[model samples]
Target chain A: MIQQKIPGKPVTVTINGKKYRANEGEILLSVAIREKIEIPHLCFEASLDPYGACRLCMVEVVRKGKREMATSCTLRAADGLEVLTDTPEIEKHRSILFELYLAEAPKSDVIRDMAAHYGVTRTRFLKRIEQGDPLGNKCVLCGLCVRACSEIMGAGAINFINRGPYTVVNTPYYAPSRDCFGCGACVRVCPTNAIEMEDVGADRVMKSWSDTRVPLSQCECCGRYYAPRELSASVLARLDTPLKEEIARLCPECRGKQLAQNEILAGRGGRATHG
Target chain B: MDERTLDAIIARHDAPAGRLLGILGEIQNQEGYVPRETLELLSEKLGVRLSQLYGLATFYSYFTLRPVGDHVITVCMGTACHVKGAVAILEALEGLLGIKSDVTDDGKLSVTTIDRKFTVEIARCFGACSMAPVLRIDGNLYGYATPEDLPVILGEYGWTP
Candidate 1:
């Protein structure tokens, strides 16, 4: 069993006049959320590293007669620090951030959830034109896929490229990457349904977090979907050098069948005969 | 407007998180960094404490405690950039400037080393992946960079080789 580290020292902090003790170095937001303090957050995930990009976890912290607004995910507990999870200023900032995210990626359920919770339905900003969305704007630019790929999976198959306003995540050469493991971790972490799994009979097409099409494959045996076309081809190439026709003809099950038939024909037929 | 008026405006208006970041960003833009005094004033007017304010400021990578230089040099360390030897280029810059990421040179050139910048930050693939090892000085993008090109790029920016 993998050992999990329990915090050695516990620290005391006050939230809205209520005192709570938590482990040192633990994120203030996670502990507050666990304690049911109703701290608003949008870009934080327990499974992944804290990305303060969304700026939703802003809180008021009072320490030694000083007060300031900060993101709870990246801050640690300090002795005698007083925290306020909700205030008009914090609420206002969170609402506007949600609006900006909405203007960019209006169709995200995660954004919708935060909007509903925060009582934000409309704003003064004009509705942004859905630039890349074929169906509609869905991606919120949360960086989950990038973090999962680089930090968790250890395969830097994809990443954000370019600078402001025109940045995009892509493989090297804009061609299919050789490093992807077909894990679909990016697809799973997307906040917007912009990234989709398209099942095309024998193939699986993956839409990017921003709705760019990344064609994947469907296993022939169970018809389960896999990763991008280039990734699948590379994986198959590593195992054996099969002609395209041969590969197309054999799914996992059919390939197993071909191997069994070849074995039987090679005088390993005794097992078949017994059966 | 004076500090009192600025504090009054922050207190009177009910700004959301994005607007707050924008407001704080504006303050940073004006002052070159978010002053501790400004944060304290915001907290007192907004009824929040100092620790909470510091938490928000430190949480996002964009907010900086120290002053930055006039020009910002951001080197892309994304996978494509890395594969094409972005590390070497970054090392060259560090060697030349005697500074690291998030630090400005004594001459006031702020250099930030990031894997990705905003906008294209959420891109599934950088379309210019063909141009591996890219760098962006301010907003201008350069591609297919080598260690040899570093001196030329810096020299163009008035940095001697």
Candidate 2:
């Protein structure tokens, strides 16, 4: 008896005339990205859901004799879902989008390099450069950091404040966020590396969010401050069984060494001493 | 509103009409503005994020986060009203309140007096173009209002000083 290992009926999607196997209802952008197809995207994070705010991955879907443009990140895969990644219309759209991004985040080398890759080096739009911007004037306002913090970390520390043209992502009242776990999920998920975080002494300073400081946990063995205390505590709480008292206070590297030592000692039928 | 009153309001809205907007609207109507403490309490009680509530409060012009004055003076700044010296009326109210119109960092619209006696604001329109340069104080409309009519109209609302 043949069994399907993956969920969703296997469907082949044609991208740039090459057919690739994917599950039905899977994101088209995910399929294109997995198959090494050249589709430029910014706001798509594998951990978080597709937001489609960047509009960089616009692809043309052909059905019968008609064509429709849609964001590949939000587009779902189905059988015979023929799509062109770099059609003339998509190129024109990408060129204008790159120009807009260039103007929006002029200080970002990531944007400049990516734009130059697609042959868009100049923009006619007025450049926006705020003096002493905490995000280093590189934020494209893609909401990836905001969404990652709230959705992934359950922090909900930052969000889109104000409205319309004045909209910006930051802590409430632009004050130091009391709820930030200092998990660095936002810094990791930021497509343009707009979020700034640094561990200063005993506290992790979220410089972008009004210098929000979260306390760092000191390792028992190394006596070095490693992770945020709250974040470590939260992660420990999720385990089925709590770690041993001595092992819980050590950092990841030290903890791994201690666990391996304990395994060898247990095999030798001897009690292991806490290093 | 006190914490108890806020709890009661949330309890009342918690059942059939537990929508966040409706609950916030009720708070605005009762308290003139949604207080930060009240929003925090609402976030905890309703299991909604504080940022989400703050976003909603700031997005809508009807909801204000700061404490408003006892008497709210709203001058319409619609196209018809602006043509008829609406700016003059707003300036007059600012002068009467002894406070300059300052836009805060959060983009809040209304400006309240220092003593918290009065708040002057601008509205897009009241849809009463026949009464161009219209002003409303405590929900009472003054049609065809002038800068000169402010002191007298405010006097009626216990602004004798």
**Regions more than 4 Å wrong, model 2:** A1-5, A126-128, A131-133, A240-247, A256-275, B16-18, B158-161
Complex DockQ, candidate 1: 0.02
DockQ, each predicted model:
0.02, 0.56
lDDT of 2 by residue, A1-275 (tens): 12223668989999988899999988899888888898998999877777889999999999996999999998989999999988899999999999999999999988998999999999988888878777888989999988888887888998888777567788877788888999998899888888899999999999998899999999988888998998877777776443646445888889888889888997798776543
The candidate scoring highest on TM-score is 2
**Please, what are the lDDT tens digits per residue for candidate 1 over residues A71-91?**
998877777768887778788
RMSD of every prediction: 21.4, 3.9
| Candidate 1 chain B minimal-lDDT segment of 10 residues | B115-124
Best by DockQ: 2
Candidate 1 segments exceeding 4 Å error: A1-4, A131-136, A172-174, A209-275, B1-161
For each of the candidates, give the backbone clash count: 34, 0
User: What tens digits encode model 2's per-residue C-alpha lDDT throughout B1-161?
Assistant: 78788877777775555389888999999989998888888888888888888888887888988899988988898999999999888888888878888666666568888889899888899999998989988999999898888889988988865
